[model samples]
Target: MQEISYPEKIDPRLHIYPSQEADRLKSRLLEHHETGILDAIGRELFTRMDTAGLVPIFVLRGGLALKDAYVEAAGFGPAGVIVPWRARHTEDPTVSYASLPVVPGARYALVDTLIASGRTIIACLQALRVRVPGARVDVVAPFLATAGRERVIADAADTHIHCVWHAEDVDGDGRMVGPGFDVGDLVLGWQGRHLVWSGERGERA
Candidate 1:
């Protein structure tokens, strides 16, 4: 078996995404809902976020990342979750950016399937600040990369992160090392056409 590396002091905000514990959680979630286990996980995530006084906003990107966002929002009950703004950013240094319309002094919860280097989330938070000024933001994801987590922690002081698992490394394309696959790919594939991969179980793809 291959060894996986994690942070020395594991973050309390981080939860194990793929493991016996998660499987057990899934089993418990299934007692109330009939959707796939991932959706069950999304619903569970919403419950946690609600306890924290946060709302869910699905990222606009396609695939499981977006699906998980919708699923989380749906789990928020009748009124649904808030999606105050939608913005996208790139890594290109020469590119210009703009902020979207936001409610001043409002709090938002950003949801995505995975975090690679934290660039996109940072950009999104920055844009939100432009519109809402003192807006507070929380990021939620099923998985997060260590480098990405560090980058966000260093650059964005006010933003909170809630994720189920953390990995040592994730490439620019979002493929995590040791696991040797991307959660986005697996989740999106599962959501789209019923494709399945070994990485969902923490096995190399």
Candidate 2:
């Protein structure tokens, strides 16, 4: 990774959560994806979206936590629920039904707390393949783990992963351009930088 760097300012909303809150959230979302740092990263993401006519689409299971956070950040009236069910630890999505209720003809954004291994995204694609069909997919997350980022490309394949910022590393091995604040595996390395999902190739459906 590159040298460490911090932005002129870290978003204010992220600071709203007390250090204890981050610890508690970290424990809950440990196996649940990336809720710990999502709060920290969500501020940058919310700023990008502007919440102007924005509806949220959480990928169920994995995205449930993110959806909850997004709603808390943006509110329920501004954001609606649409969950896509897909297996996380298993390869079979049929076991859980891969679909979410999209209000149909409504503009929405997909939010996930983290993209750790991109398995969430792969499973998400399987579910969305039938439910959403031809809709545009916008992904949001806090930290895109070093190992997880590789799969993000394959998972995104042909869509955009619009997040606040993607960290180069969070393992504390000192590889990330910036170090994530100590919050277990969850941390905010940097803010206000984005990378295009070049994996979005052709005929994702």
Model 1: how far residue 162 lies from native, Å: 0.3
The digit string of per-residue lDDT tens for model 1 on 7-104 reads 34555544443444444653443353323555655554544454334444555331234454444554442111222222222322111333333444
Best by lDDT: 1
User: Tens-digit lDDT track for model 2 on 53-118?
Assistant: 566666544455455456666776544334333222243223143333456564456566655545
Residue 34 of model 1, lDDT score: 29
Those runs of model 1 whose alpha carbons end farther than 4 Å from true positions after fitting are 1-35, 51-53, 62-105, 172-174, 178-205
Q: What TM-score does candidate 2 reach?
A: 0.51
List the global CA lDDT of all models.
0.50, 0.46
